[model samples]
Target: MLLIGGSVLVGVFTFIYARLVCTFICSLPPAVLARTVGVLTLFHIVLRELLLRFSPLQGERSTPARRAWLLSVVSWSLTGLLAIVIHVTRYPAFPAPSHLKFAVGYWALGGGLLAQVEYLLFERALPPTPTLSPEAQLRERLGRRLIEGYVIFTSVPVLVLMLTLQRFIYELHGDLRYLLEAVVLAAGFTGGALAVAIAYGRSLRRDSEQLLEAVRRVGGGDFQPGAVTSRPDELSLVAAGINEMAGGLQLRERIREAFGRFVSPQVATEFIEKYARHGKTAVLGGSRRNVVVLFSDLRDFTRLSESLEPEVLIEVLNGYFQEMVGAIQRHGGLVDKFIGDAVLAVFGLTEGQGDPAIAAVSASLEMRRRLEAYNARLAERGLHLNSGIGIHAGEAVAGYLGSTDRLEFTVIGHTVNVASRIEGQAREPRPPLLFSEEVARRLGDAFTVKEVDTVALKGVAGEMRLLTVEGEARSVRAA
Candidate 1:
């Protein structure tokens, strides 16, 4: 609409100027001038519409090189036809027909130059072309160069034709003014084209720098989405994709936080590593591993719960479990599960450390020391509590268990059951820590332990020997 309105205003101004001030130079009547302006305006509009329909600048079709070539040919043909029409038409008062022909040629040259600039702008704004292959990238670069070359090559011929006509005019009239005017006009057009090219190059360089900085931030694990430009162009799409990727990483970090709360850190890390390496199938199977199982239970917890208020009991139990779990974790043990006031822990589930049975024994001795200190705090409130621990070493089938919907990674065998029974034996009038003969043999006199009576535990085929560590439950000075 702007183009059409501007053309109409120019045509009206030309009609008025030719009728009033330029009557000597332009002898054409007002009606003829008006008809000529209207025809030329309509021709310009039709030429532009045809160029848009066939040009790759519109982005409606593929094979941009072919389409661009076709548009260039049609544009030059139309320009030549317009120039010929101007040359053939007779204006009796006009000094020379070459002046009018030069004007037509100049208009066509300016339009072609402007069209090239517009096509470059449109190409820069287009979405990223897929250039995954080296050949595709080379082709894209070559195509851009070809288009630019075509624009420059086509413009040179038009300028040459216009200059040749001006030379003809000068030869007929013996004037030097036409040559000077042509030189000045060509210089102005060249300078303007250079300025436009430089501005476009600067803008492209700035956008590319911003994109590189954004990519660097993403690489450093900074997932905060940066401010993006509002332009509806290829750079805007790239910024949007980067922001989406950062959002996904933020969500993954949140999931990791929540997952850590549901399982031990060792289990969580192992599970994630295995899942990454072998997908979901990694956790489906089980293996028989030689591990040390430990179980601990608060003594007389049912009767004590009956005495204390629910809130107080909960507070006391939480504190006790926190200290015990910390001691176990410090000595390289994984707390498998907590059943009310009881804890089931295992060592050597994933990585085999040096003497897992010794580690379990060390953790148990630490727990006994922690409990004694805990009892002193209880003594302040006119309350007393004790705990029992049992340790055993054997081979157990350890892996993820339960249904697909809900799974648990744990050890399942007679060894775990025996550990539980040994914990029950702590209720007798003996040391509060006990272990099977298997664990005692593995220790090899690391600490003094006395063998207890051989008795058949439930579900066991024969009598199993047990041992209790001396001085484990003895009171020590609080530090």
Candidate 2:
């Protein structure tokens, strides 16, 4: 459809130019005029076919080249010029100035319109390409288009008018005054055209700067959309693209925040980063690594739930978890999951020099301190809560677990079972927090610990000794 439409359009313009020049301007015979139009139209159709057949274009970069249009226009204009040369060679009286002016104007206007229409038709026919980045689109160079348009529309017409006037003056044997007036008029026209071109160029430069600034802001983590112009050009498209990109980034951040509430923020961040780096192929799999697991549970939660209303029970539980989780996070621990009235957290998920056991112990102490502050606030409502925490450091399989539809990042091994049993032994008489012997081995002398008790934990061969953190050793204590 595009090829046929473009060919017919080009043929129609060729016939019109031929009729105007041969019949109206030169008064050629009808038979000769038909032959001239047929030859010119056929020549153009052949050239257009060749251009279509071999042209290589892909995606947006396939927009018709300026050189292709220029070649078509020049070929048609040269054919017309050759016909004129032949006519003048055969009939010496045909060398008229009026004829030359008409020919030049026809080639400049008519031929340009034909080439432009052909370009538009081809552009409409091309298949759409995927959206390219702003950087890629900027490489298309709109500046070059601006310069080419200025030369074609501004310079060419002015040059033709000046030449026509010069020829008329010479033919009439006019004085130097007429030539000077022509020169002045041409200069004025040139200057005005130049000023307009400069203003348009500056506007383009400003728009380009705005695009660059928007790209910089997006790169700097500002996901707010930028201002877009109403201009009907590639710059407008680029601005729209930037706005879309910003909106996508902003949505991703929102997803991350919501996801963090469902899981550890560190885990959520890692998930997002993997998605960004590996896209759909990214997977969360288990890894065996040494880590410290902490388990904390509100003591006598069943009796407390029976006493308070469901809403009040939930409120108290949320407040407790918030304080405990804050303490854990401050010590570089990840709150893995919440199990009803129990809270499970992991440290050393991200490997570092600091001992995960020390962080787990410090977090338990902070949890104890934060709990005191929380109970004071709860005293106004005639309510109090107590929680026991257990820490154990050992190798465990840590990663996403569960069915394909749903998964949770957590640690699983005998170490986790030992931590839970140790917390169970932390009754009223003993300290509210306890740790396994494995944790004590990692504690060194940094913290003062005492043998709490021995308890046979489930899935373990023998009884594991429990220890309670009293305080930091005097040598390492703050003054």
Model 1 TM-score, all chains together: 0.55
Q: Among all windows of ten consecutive residues in candidate 2, which has the lowest summed lDDT?
A: 470-479
C-alpha lDDT of all candidate models, in order: 0.68, 0.72
| lDDT of the structure predicted as candidate 1 | 0.68
Error of 1 at 135 (Å): 24
Q: How many backbone clashes does candidate 1 have?
A: 0
Candidate 1 lDDT over 1-479, as tens digits, reads: 54445445544554454454332435555576677656765775677567756554433233344345446446544644664466356444354543344343324443444445534544554443342343333334444445455546555665766556464555455466767776777667766775665565456555555665677788888888583754668878888888898887777666666765677777777777677435665446578998999999998899999999999999999889888998898888999888999999998785655678888888888898788888888898888878889888999888888876678878889899999998888767757888999998988767677887677888878888888766544312110
Put down candidate 2 lDDT per residue, 211-313, tens digits, no spaces: 8888899989998847476476988999999999899888889999999999998998988887653675445568998899999999889999999999998
Deviation (Å) of 413 in candidate 2: 1.6
